[model samples]
Target: MSHLLIPALFFLVILVGAFIQPAAARKPYASIPVKNLFSYIEILPPGSRVLLAWDYDPATQGEMQLLAQPILRHLQRKRVQIVNVSLRPFGPNVAADAQTMKQWPMSAQAAAPTEFGFIPGESAALRALTHSPVIASNQPRTSARTSGLRPTDTLAAFDLVIEFSASFANSQEWVEQVASRTQKPFIVAASGAVAPLLRPYQQTHQIRVLLSGYPDALAYESLLQHNGPAHRQRTAQTLALGLLLILVLIAATRSLLRR
Candidate 1:
């Protein structure tokens, strides 16, 4: 039947394309956004405190994991104190995976970023951040290992805030509450679908750096001169899309011949 045949054929094409690596001849263009991000990240002095908000769950891990990996590595390389907080339940796990995969803290003495765990109330929690920095998971800050994350410290103390979000609502919360109050610089690694939605804020310069989807991730990887999972995913995606178009043309031609 045509129904079964079409899906089977499409699956076959994608299977073949996944194994076929895309050509590397195409020059990867690093965009102004990525460059701006690099500049912002580079300007931070060593030991600067950063608030990293993970607002997406595991559902978007495939897209976000690669994007966040390089940035985390770069931050670790700079020796900044990273404080991770999450609105989504699964986000902390993803952040842990990213740190482990990237092998951050190159030195044994360097401690991993403090994980504040998940905060339940989205808008309310963000509002609390303005009033009280330690909203959820108020662990003791006694250890020098906390990298100066004292219980008394407010969110304003952080040098910068970077949010990796998959949802428009999550990004909006950051824009409205976090950005409005602190007046601190913000960087976002957003899912492609949500990137356009956040552009208006970027236009006004509320968002300092915005990176969307696999292409931007690949571009960042290229800028880092480190070929990683994003490169592999891009190759597979390109090859599969190319093959899919060819399949469509062939199907159309065959239908015309039968007619």
Candidate 2:
């Protein structure tokens, strides 16, 4: 009873504070990370090759899609060559969507995005990308695997592989299977829930850039102020946090006065 009551009262206090304070604004989820990503892209040289590793599905698109699209846009803006691969079956197609594509500042030099259609088997498939890539993006120049990729194509000639996944087959797979074997840089953008596990990878440098949640995204948005969804989300988040603080203070004061 105490556990429920005290927390509930605090929530009520927070609600009241939100009504009174100007900080309760709601921002989009993508704003924070987008800004951080923007800065990262700004540092990269033009014409860099980036591999978009889509590893989630339609259900989680809302949280991840916006996050992924803006990064792709920023990379494309810089004329980055993108090679899209998916350990998840739906990842490759999601990577191909233009809504995700439009954000990039694509240039004449940008290679038409490459889709290495879903890797039929993750463990073995990921391992294959390390030494040489056997993957083929279903471009018309090639259709069937025979017309397409060889074992030599596994991890050839790419700069960085950005992994966007929402599954147990996580950054670890990219690390143990691909990055470890090939020594290629692996960047990961995963949901908050998976952050604890990913942190060790980042600390040890198994993954290069790791973004955990809305907080990181918001921080990035705050940094760039790019006037994109990330910025808008920051505004909303600022407002919401302000309100929450106010409510906490009010509740504490009320309790003290009563005592």
Candidate 3:
């Protein structure tokens, strides 16, 4: 009964909280990382080319999607030409969905970001991007031609590399094979559990920005002053956690009185 009651109450609170839209101002520590991410995107001039790697699959999409959406929206607002690629098979599809789900005017939509589909060879594929960008894409010849991306071009052509991943291997591969070699600034948006493992790289100055989980998401939303999916997720998380903690305390008090 306690188990059922606690979870039922939790879901009830979360369901109610998810509807509220306002995201409170975040603490200084939480705001710092989000501000750094925004600053990187803000520095690029309009129409600068950016390579965005969508590295997570559907199993982790709920969290990753929420994290990626605001950044994509921010990039679109800046009028950058985005070339998106993926290592995982379903990654292109996930990236497509995140773009489609964003609230942008059909007319104001920046040129639809180019999708390079999926690259099969992991570290080898990433290395190829630095040397032979077009062939590494595996994109149809005509599509590459239309985008004006020559086979001679390399990853160095892009102004920046931003990766959203749930996999540590994907993140590590990017750092060791791509960013470290190309010497281009890189950013990562990772699931909270995986963020700690990747933090050491940031400390060593291998990457620029790292955003992890709901707290960071809320901070980003506050920075943007635009509430979206992350706000909903944060509300749900906070309400559920707060309710569960209260329930535990009540149960302890009741047991003490009975004793």
Name the best candidate (by lDDT). Answer: 3
lDDT of 2 at 40: 65
Error of 3 at 73 (Å): 0.8
- Compute the lDDT of residue 91 as modeled in candidate 1: 78
Off by over 4 Å in 2: 1-40, 98-111, 134-156, 222-224, 235-259
Worst 10 residues of 1 by lDDT: 135-144
Query: Residue 114 of model 2: what lDDT?
Result: 55
Q: Between which residue pairs do clashes occur in model 1?
A: none
Candidate 1, residues 160-184, lDDT tens digits: the string is: 8999999999999888988878767
Residue 102, candidate 2: Cα error in Å is: 3.4
What digit string (tens of lDDT, one per residue) describes model 3 on residues 95-194?
Answer: 9889878876631757667878899999999899889778898887666654557888888888889999999999999999987887677999999778
From the highest lDDT down, the ranking of the candidates is 3, 1, 2
Candidate with top TM-score is 3
Tens digit of lDDT per residue, candidate 2, span 1-259?
Answer: 3345567667777666655443225433544334545656777776566667888887777677646655665676676666667877777667766344464344444556655678767777776667555433333434323223454655656666788877646567887887676555677888766667777887887776778665655555444444555555555766777677776766766765565
Which regions of candidate 3 deviate over 4 angstroms? 1-29, 145-147, 235-259
Deviation (Å) of 32 in candidate 1: 1.2
Q: Please give the TM-score that candidate 2 achieves against the real structure.
A: 0.67
lDDT of 1: 0.78
